[model samples]
Structure formats: C-alpha cells, structure tokens
Target: MEGQRSKVSSCSFVSYCFLFWVQLLPLATGGKVPALIVFGDSSVDAGNNNFIPTVARSNFEPYGRDFQGGKPTGRFSNGRVPTDFLSEAFRIKPYIPAYLDPKYNISDFATGVTFASAATGYDNATSEVLSVIPLWKQLEFYKTYQKNLRAYQGETTAKGTISEALHIMSLGTNDFLENYYTSPGRSTEYTPQQYEDFLVGIAGNFIRKLYGLGARKISLGGLPPMGCLPLERTTNVVGGNECVSRYNDVALEFNGKLKKLTTSLNKELPGIRLVFSNPYYSLMHIIRNPAEYGFDSTSVACCATGMFEMGYACSRGGMFSCSDASKYVFWDSFHPSEKTNGIIAAHLVKTALAQFLE
Candidate 1:
C-alpha cells in the first residue's frame, strides 16, 4: 500500500514538472516574440539598398568598420543603426532585413519587420531628389507584406501579429535635407515652416494608414537636432562654425506639435499605443554635452572631410578622413555613430518600448 502511494506521488510530481516546463517554454525559447515593424529613412535603413538600384547605397568601405564582421552591412551608420540595438533590447534578433531584399529571410519576418527606405522621406519630392525608394513605395511594400503575412500565419494570426508589433518610424529629416533645402520644386512651393506643416500632415496620414492596417503600437521619431549635423553645418549656411539654430527650432516646433497631435489621436482611437521617440532631445543632449556622452569630437564625423560632407559626399579619395571613429559623434555628415546608436537605442527602449511591449 505504501509503494502504491509512492507511485501516485511520483506521477503527480511528474505532472507538475511537465506543467512547469510548459509554462517556462515561452520565456525559455522566447516564444511568439513581439514583432518590430520599422519604417523610415537612412537613419533607420537596415540594408534595404542591397536589393534596390538606388545611389543611396552604403554596402561599401568604411561604412561598417565598427560592426561585428568589420564589413559594410548596408547600414547608413558606421556600424549598427538604432533599429539594430532596439531589436537587441527587444530580444528579437540582431539584423532586421529590408522587405525589398531579395535575400530577405521570410521565416524571420514572423518575429521582425522592416520597411525603411534609405533616402526616403514624407515628401514625394524627396525621393526624386535622392533617386531612392519613396515613402509611398515603402507603404506599398507594407501592404504587400500584410498579404504575405496573412498567407504565412493565417488571417487572425496576422492581424494579431501587426496589432502586437511596434511600428517604428524615423523620417522627415530627408524631406527637409534634400527637398526643402536643396530642391527647386519644394523650395518654390513652401517656406521652411510651411514645409514642416506639410510634412507633419504626411506623418499624420502615415499613422492613420498604419491604424487602418491594424497597427496599434506606433513609435514615431521626432527629427534630431538637424542644426548640429555635419551636413547642415557645412552646406550652404554661411559663417557658422556652430550648428544652425533655425533647423533646431524647426525640429523643436515640429516635435511639440506632433506631441499634441498624438494626444488628440489617442483620444480619438482608444486602446491604441502612440509613442514618440524624441531623437531631438537625445541628440541635442549629446551635442550640447559631448564630453559627457564620451564623444570628444561631436561636431566632426569619422568619415572623409570629418566635418561637413556625408553619404556619397563624404568620400575618402575626394577629401580627408579621420583615423579613430570613437571620438566623433557623427559617422558621416548625417547619422550617428554606433556608440551613439547604442545610447539612443537604450533610451528608446525604456521610453518607447518597455511599457508598450509589456
């Protein structure tokens, strides 16, 4: 009778163990991890150009010296972009493939998302200026992706996937940089403030579109301190060793307006998550207190020219290049270094992701 009792107790213990393991499975294997659907410009482009014919390509030398493989991975940054670190903090994966990449691993799309088009912006004219993928094209990609996802995971599952995922957007800088600043067409139509308003309208439209497509958690990035970037500092502006405050003012104004708009949007759409990552604040803080951020050369870039030129303009054979990249904040004329990306990613994780993901 004692043996029989012992056998029953063992069976009960085994059942408990099985249940415990079942409960721990998701946490153990990181099961059904929330997806990170990204959409933006070069600042967030994760090797999208590898599949495009755009001249905005960055899969070349001195682009990824700080990356794990020490080779260009088509990221506009010197190493990893903000999305890379954000994905890491989320514990999804390292690299998020561009939806357009011919080699894109579809299986991973279940856990990750990328619609960022390099050199793209809210304005249609911006794409023409850069001869790169446009925001409209990116949206089209998303539309097609929604179909593919439904096919892959079924309708109910796909809707749930999109609803649960975090939709990240970091655009508008290019609209200002390439169009409002340089292009004849946009400049003729709108002043700086007018252009800002127009772009914000586009941003709002984009958000609404995402909501229509079943996205709930949306993280829209505010423009960085554009005045401080090497590109803005060097190009066209006169007698400015320092950054142009006009650009910074525009960023501040746009971000402020967007914040207010988001509040209203939340009330309009209940149970929706709308987060804005203020890259303006984070980038401005580092620019103002470069030493504190561990960057001695905040004004200069590590690439050629080391001061103003960025993207294709920052070429080694054409101009000068710096030795150590760690000292500088700007990787080229436009984007942040991998270290800065890490810093920005850390803050974003806490602010934009922690609560949303939870």
Candidate 2:
C-alpha cells in the first residue's frame, strides 16, 4: 500500500487556510435539519479533548491541515470529521462548535454543539486508561450544555431546540479497544459475550438518559469493522494482510445486539426516534473494494507509520504524511481520513438518517 512510507508534513500547527471552500463551502443534502448535537469519542469530537485534562488531544500539527484554517482543532482526523459533514448536510453550520469553547458566544449555541471527548467510552475504566471523559461525565456536560441553552434562549425555544435537534452518538469503539481488548482487568472479569452484553446495557442506559434530557431524534453509530483498522491489523493474532476476524466477530456481535437495543428503545420509549447507524456496512464496503470507492489503500494510514502511529505521533514535525491523503481510507492508525468520513457520513445520511427525517 502507498501508506507504508514514513515521510511527514513540515508546516507548523498554525497555518492559515488559503482556501475558503474548506469550511464555508456548502454541502448538498435533501433533509432539512435544525441542529446537530453530537456525543461519543474522537470520531465526532470537534475539540472537546483539547479542553480536557488529557493527553489524548489532537491539538497539534498535521491533525487539521485540511480543516477550516489549516490549524489543529483537536480532531484526530486529517481534517474535518463526520459531525462537521453532518452539520453541512443539515445546513445548520459549516462546523459544530464545542460547548466548552469560551471563544464562541451563546449565539453559537443556536445550532447544537458537540459534547464528545476523544478516547472516551461507555466504560469508566476505558476513559480511565486514557485519562479522558467517561460516558457518565459526558452526560453531565450535556446537562450543562442544556442548561446554558435554556439560559441563552428562553425556556420554550430551548425546549423546542432540544426536541428538534438531531442527536448523534459515535461511541462504544473505545469501550472495546481501550477496555475489553487492552485492559487486562476486563478480560479477566468477563468473557466476550458477557462484555458485549455489558456494553449494550451501558448504551441502552445512555440512550434512556438522552431521552430524559428531551432528545427526540437520536442516531447512534454502531461499531465499525474494528478488526480492519490498521492498529487492529498490526495487533491481531492472525497476522498477515488479512483483517482480524475475531475482533470483527466482536464488533458484529455488538452491532447486532446494539440494533436490537435501539429497536426495543424505539418501541418502549414513546416519541423518541432512535436509529442504529451500522458503520460496518459502509466501512467494509470501502475496504473490500477500495478501488470502486476511489481509495488506493485500505489497510494502511496516511500519517506517520500508518500501521500504529497517530495523534502526537502523526504531527507535522514528526513522521511522513502521504502526498494524497484522499487515496487512503485512514488518516492515522485509528482515525479515518476526511474523505472516508465524508463518504460514510453521506451514506449514513441517505440510508439511515434520511428515513427518520421529517
């Protein structure tokens, strides 16, 4: 694959973007959405990790060279993330602001904001490993955001905004990666099936909490083909060019159960539109046949070593980055490139979110 090279970018963390179309550009979509409120991990985190007391932040070079101003914004991708694209799709704003960002005033909260923290997960132990925000803590931040919204916009308008906003969750990946697989404690305590059930329960509880917070339109992203990630490929026991089937088995099991959980929640929780967005289908679709999707490499990343380096390791002054990042599916060992995120977001909007659109 073209991603095996170890060259890197030479720019600083504060490069001014010459292109206006990167952030101000309007993306096309059929659905009319008011706002996008996002939660979960690095996948959807705009800059929540930057404010957090955690080293899991991506506020460094090469992290956002493709972003609005070509400056790092604490997103782990090569550029704009899924929520940014989803915001564009909804015509809410070019980028969803982080609630913790003091620079943006209350008017910025008119459209929804992101409460996601990079490296966070359903399990407290998962976030403990990385010293980032946990699921429960993220919920607390959501509560604070809601309180601010009510203060910023009168109670009635805030209530309507909370009910009408498109809420999205990109969680659970770290619960597996950082907890089940990496943590020796979890494996010793529970089997694979037991762990899956535990995480599903956590997810269910979180969704219920969101419903209680007046979130009506909720879309949760299921686990991707975790085995196919470059990091997983390198770490998987069944090594070679093939993906780790056992890891994917874990993800598949989780996705099926997660879908069932959402279905049950939708049936029981009256007036809540819960959707299980299975990213596995879209991710694997590109992996199995990269050429059709215009991707040149699916097994390797565009930054650093491509197989195992990311975040600080993928910085501009560190290792080599691909000349054409769009050709690769992954921006780093764990995160997808902006192109791949756009593709998956577009697919989800059309297939998953479109169905529930009013």
Which candidate number has the best lDDT? 2
Q: Could you say which candidate leads in TM-score?
A: 2
lDDT string, candidate 1, 20-82, tens digits: 433432344343347888898988887887777777878876677666666677888767788
The Cα error of candidate 1 at residue 257, in Å, is 1.6
Predicted candidate 2 versus true structure: per-residue lDDT over 1-358, tens digit per residue? 3433332342212112212223343344323457788888999988888887888988887688777666788888877788887786676676788867777766886786888888988888898988988889878988988888899888998898889888899988888887888879999999999998998899899999999999999998899998899988877654775798888999999999999998899999999989988899899999999998678888888886688888776774344677667778998999998888888877787778876444
TM-score of each: 0.87, 0.90
Candidate 1: segments with Cα more than 4 A from true spot: 1-33, 236-238, 315-320
For candidate 1, what is the TM-score? 0.87
Off by over 4 Å in 2: 1-32, 316-319
What 10-residue stretch in candidate 1 is worst by lDDT?
A: 1-10
RMSD of 2: 4.6
Q: What is the RMSD of candidate 1?
A: 13.1
- Show pairs that collide, candidate 1: none
